[model samples]
Structures are given as structure tokens and as C-alpha cells.
Target: MDGDVENAPLTDEQVSDQWKRLADLINKLQARTDTKDEFNARPGSSLTGDDAWSPPFHVSHAVNACIVAGADHLHACKTLVVDAHSLHVAAPASLIRGSLENMAAAFWMLHPTSRAERVTRCLRWQMVNAKNARRALAPLDLKDPASYDERIATILEVAQRHPEIDIAAVKRGFTSTAAVTYADEHSGAALGVLLPWQLCSGFAHGFTWANLAFSERVEIPTADPDVFSVRFSTDLTRALYLVWAATNLTESVLKLHAQRSTPQY
Candidate 1:
């Protein structure tokens, strides 16, 4: 599945078809709605009582939030390409990476049929969110130091109440590095989610190895023998296909979110 978009070259017709599909998917994603975008009073998101259940937290807020972000990333990608008039070497893949990660998070939360696991994924994502915020604020002098801790405690408290969720599993929270692969399995995309994500990740980080793997390099003749100058150029077809993978995964998220969302009253 991941091999659907590989280092191997595609024919002209294949390129044209995939590129058109990419555009169509992006257009569809932009047009999609985020209905029932509401949330409960937090510390917990629940059905009836003071108990902060995980299910409502995801269905009501987190999934919508994630899909919205994925849409924004694709919007940004379009803006960048239009503004620059070309893929601009690395930026498209970087933007696509972010979109895929956002979609992957949403998919991971919503793909599960069991409500307990679904909510658990959302809880872990939020737990990580709080932890990150706390770490970012650690160097600064904050008025309330325990705010993030309270958030973490809140997630754990909810997890504790759900007997099906293993307490230890939610400790570290969610990270796309491991979960992206799992989410990709359900994406229903020809070009699977994980490889494109990985390729885009390398571009996002500006890794030399990623460039070496994906780009065409030609040695430049330099007067100074000591300076081994080289020119690197990106393959537009390859870049587009990677981004297409992101759109496919994101489109899946949008549809899944609609199914999971409460109907608008």
C-alpha cells in the first residue's frame, strides 16, 4: 500500500491522473462541514453526571478540532503553492506532513468501534497536549503552575474510571510516530499513510538523508576542489503523490468525523 507512491517513477498518464485526484480530494476536503462542533464544560466531557467520560470528549470537541486543523493545513498548502508558483522543494511535503499527522490523530480516535478505546485515544492526545504546554511553560514564570497538572490529573481520573482502558497506556499520551502506521491501515488509500508521512517528516525536519533519497542531485563543477558543491532538485510528481496520500487520509477523517458527530439540532 505504502509502495503505491515510491521512489520509482510513474508514467505521464499516472502522474496526470494522481495529480487530478489530489486536487479533487483537496477541494472536497475544503468543502466538507464540521457539524455539531460543540463541547461540554471541561475538566470532563460526559453524558449526565460529574464523571468526565472520554467518549463525549472526543465526539464533541477533539475530533472536530483535529479535522479542522487538517483542513487548515491543506489550505495552507494551496496558498503556498499558489503564492510561490511551484512546490518549492521542501515546503509542500512539510505542510502535508502536518496535515497527515492531524488527520491521523483524528482517525486514530474515531476509527475504533468501541467507545472506550476511542475516548481513550482522545484522552491520551489531550494528556500529551497538556504535558507539552507544561513543558513549554516550564522555563517561564507562570502564575498558576499546577494548571497542566490538573489537566493531566483530570485525564487520568477519567481513564481510571474506565475499566477497559489500561491505566499505564494513557500515561505517556498519544504520539503520531507510532499511531500513524495504525491509522494508515484503515485509510482506504492506495498510497498508504505511513510512508508518505515518513517522507514528509524528513522534509519537515530538513534532513539531508531525506533529500538524498527523494531529490535528484548533480555535482557542480567548482574551481576549488575542496568545496564539493552539488545542486539538488525535487521531483514534482513524487511530491504531489506524497501530498495526495495526506489528502486521502484527511478525507477519511472528515467522513469518519461526520459519522461520529452528534446531529445538529
Candidate 2:
């Protein structure tokens, strides 16, 4: 079926159930190593291969962000939580590329003032709304599959604009290198700088691994519990998730209907 019919309209209650189901699927995917390998195989490219598919990790991340921010902004709404460790999320290249570029642009625009912070905040806001927009998705009546072709074309346009984001420069400033690293536990690699000791003192001390193979490990520097010699932080992960989710949600929505409708928030 086409994307829209496949994603039939869910009443508010059904939407909640579907959202929960998606989250559970993500959690199960995370915990299954065999599933990850199966997903990574180019099944369609190989005639003998089983055509198994996995939800893109970025999409799951985006789902989580919508749940998180929506819970926060919608006020008194129930929160969604998933076991990240067990979720087999393979990071989508599209989200990684788009987020890196956005970050890079913001990094270049950074200044030691509230003005820069405001811009950063706005970018983050755009990302969150775009990602969790399902509750706000407008009505669409697809006459036929081709009716949504224009939306597909727009997706191509937006994607083509993303590679222009310069993640390399942002990494150089943070990690002092253009080379990004993949944590063994990550479905995809992360590119960012290590936090300086002076700046790391104020953060939380515990973290859990996702995507890659690693024991459930938590490292707190004896002197600076909040800082790490090597690792991704929950804060960073959450922010990245927000950006990824927004991007994918936006992309997915564009492909599902005849026209793009911004939420009325």
C-alpha cells in the first residue's frame, strides 16, 4: 500500500497506542543483534537475501523526541519511555547529515551572548516541532499514489540541500579534529568534540550504551564525575535525537500526502 493508506488515521486513543507500539518495536529492535545484522544486509540488492527491514534509528529517535517534547509542551500529557539499550536503532545517514549541517551552521553563528543562544533555541524548536508533528498532521485525501509525487519531489529538494551543512568544521572545534568516531555501541557514528574538563564539571555522571556492543557501563571520572574521557552523554544523545526525529518526521510526512501542512501550534 502507499504510505498514507498504510498510515491510516488513528483517533487520539489509537494514536497513543500506535505511538506506544512504535516505541516498543524500537526497544525490541535495539536488543536484537541478529535483527540488526539482518537489517544491515542489502536484501533487495541480493536475490537470495531475506528482505527483512528495520526502522531507521533516527526515526525512532525522532519518535522519542516528539514524545518527550510533546509531553513537555503539551502539558499534563503522559510521557513515553523506552529502553534505549534494548532498542536496535541503526542511525539513518539522512538525519545524521542534516543534523550535523544544522549544528555546523549554528556553531559558525555562535557568539558569547544571549543573542546566539536565542538563535540556537529557535533552531532546536523548529527541529522539535517538525519531528513530533504527527499529532498535528493535517488531513490529506490521496486520489492515487501519484497524487503525492509532488511531496516526494519536495523531499528530494530538501535532502539535496542538506550535504551543504559543514559538520567537519564543527567537529574540529569540539574534538579538535575533522574525523568523527563511532562508539562500538552506536548504530552509526557520532562526530563531535570532547568536552573540556572545565566545562564538564556541571553535568550528570552516569550513561548507558546504545547501538554498538558494549557492556552496560558507567564511567565517572574520579575528579570530575560529570566529565568523560570517552563517551556520548545523555544530553548530547537527546539533542541529536531531537534533530534526527524532526528531520525524518518531516521527510516521512512529505512523502505520505499531497501537500505539506505545518502544525497549528
Candidate 3:
């Protein structure tokens, strides 16, 4: 993951600056076209229509780019092959929805029939490419020829062994929802993240620091009081909204991450 971007020949500081600029752009863009009730309304209820909804994907892609670029910068700066490929970079705040939409649009532009599937596919590929870029930029302790295969193997191992995530349990513990939608698109590899529920429910509050990397999507369909709907896509680099949550689920995610981080090794 770290190696892909590292080999780009860009300086660490330059890469970092790029990420910062990208992040800022995404933030401002989000602010300009805020997600309104209309946007969040039922699928057919988008008053702004299809064209207006495209911005989210753009924001998502830019943020993912930052992660990819940022990972490269990290590798270049630290010479460490971090597992940037895993479920740690798909946060709402980090992923630009507009990017996802744009990627999908471009993909379908080539093979129109596969448009729906292409959306997720392109996103997943972008994620892998970003990871590759990071891996490329990764620096090693010894100035010897770096083995791409070896680094990929390490990343795969890290992804496979990453701590398990339980979205259902966590959401239930934190929110007061009776039921939530658990939409999952298994067509492609989707990156999952835990979000701060308050951001969605809070008036004027927007995005929050998302727990970008999570193994999969688990919903609390049976939770009482608050209804939780968990939407997931195959695009590992794409962002999925809590869509709906009665309370802040950020604490639950934090606890989950903390518990998993506890070393048995």
C-alpha cells in the first residue's frame, strides 16, 4: 500500500502539502454544497436532481487521493511500509463522494451497460492504486533493491490479520435506534469506516473524524429506539454514510478500536 505512491519521486514535504491542500479543498467544497434533507431524503426525493448529487463523489475521490498521496508522503518521509491499504482510509471526512461519482462516470463512459457495477469497480481499483502508490514511495532501512512482491505480501498479511470490526454491536451500544437499514453491495471490495453519529444528526454540523479502516459492514437492525441503517459498497476507497443514526456512534467505534488494539502479542 505504502509503496505505490512512494516511488513517484515527489518529496515527502511536497506530498504532505499536496494532501493538505486536497483536504482543504474537499472541506470547502463540502461546505459550499452542504448535504441537505433533500439530499438525504428518499432516493427519488432529490430535489436538486442527479446533477446536484455528483459533488459527494468528487469530495470522496479527492479525500481518497489525499490518503493515497498522504500514505506516499508517509512512506517517503519515514521509509516505513505502512498498511495504508487496509480499512483505515475510507472515512467520510477523508473520502470525496464526488471522486467516486466521477470515477464511476468515467468507467461507464467506456462500457455503458456496466455502469452500476463500474462505479464500485473503479472505486475499488482507485483504492488499490492508491495503496500501490503508497507502497512505491515507501523507503527501506537498507538501500537495497526493494521487493514489490514482498511488500505486497506483507500488506496482504496485515489486512487479513487486522482486528475484527463489529458494526452492529457498536451501533447498538451507542445509539438508541430501533432499526437501521443495512444495505451492502458485495459486488466489489468496499472499505468500511465508523462515523461520529452526531455529525449527521447535529444541526449545521457536518463531517467528523472517521475511523476509516474497518473490516466489514455490520448493522444493528434489531436495536431499539434509534434506527440504524448501514450502507456499504464494493469500492473499498469509497465512503458510506451512516445514512441514519439516532445518536453518536463515534464512542462505540473508539471503544471497539481500542479493544482490538490491545495486544495479545
Candidate 3 lDDT, 212-231, residue by residue in tens: 23324546474565886654
Q: Distance from true position, residue 118, model 3, in Å?
A: 18
**Model 2 C-alpha lDDT per residue in residues 140-192, reported as the tens digit of each score:** 43244443444434333433333532323212222201111111111121222
Per-candidate TM equals 0.80, 0.19, 0.19
Query: After best superposition, candidate 2 residue 210: deviation in angstroms?
Result: 26
- How many backbone clashes does every candidate have? 0, 13, 51
lDDT of each: 0.71, 0.27, 0.28
Which regions of candidate 2 are displaced past 4 Å?
A: 1-12, 31-36, 39-265
Off-target runs (Cα >4 Å) in candidate 1 are: 1-21, 33-52, 82-84, 223-227, 262-265
Q: Over 4 Å off in model 3, which ranges? A: 1-8, 35-103, 106-265
Tens-digit lDDT string for candidate 1 (59-167): 4466667777877787677666544557677888888888888889878877887767776777778788889999999568674878778878887887888698757
Error of 2 at 77 (Å): 15
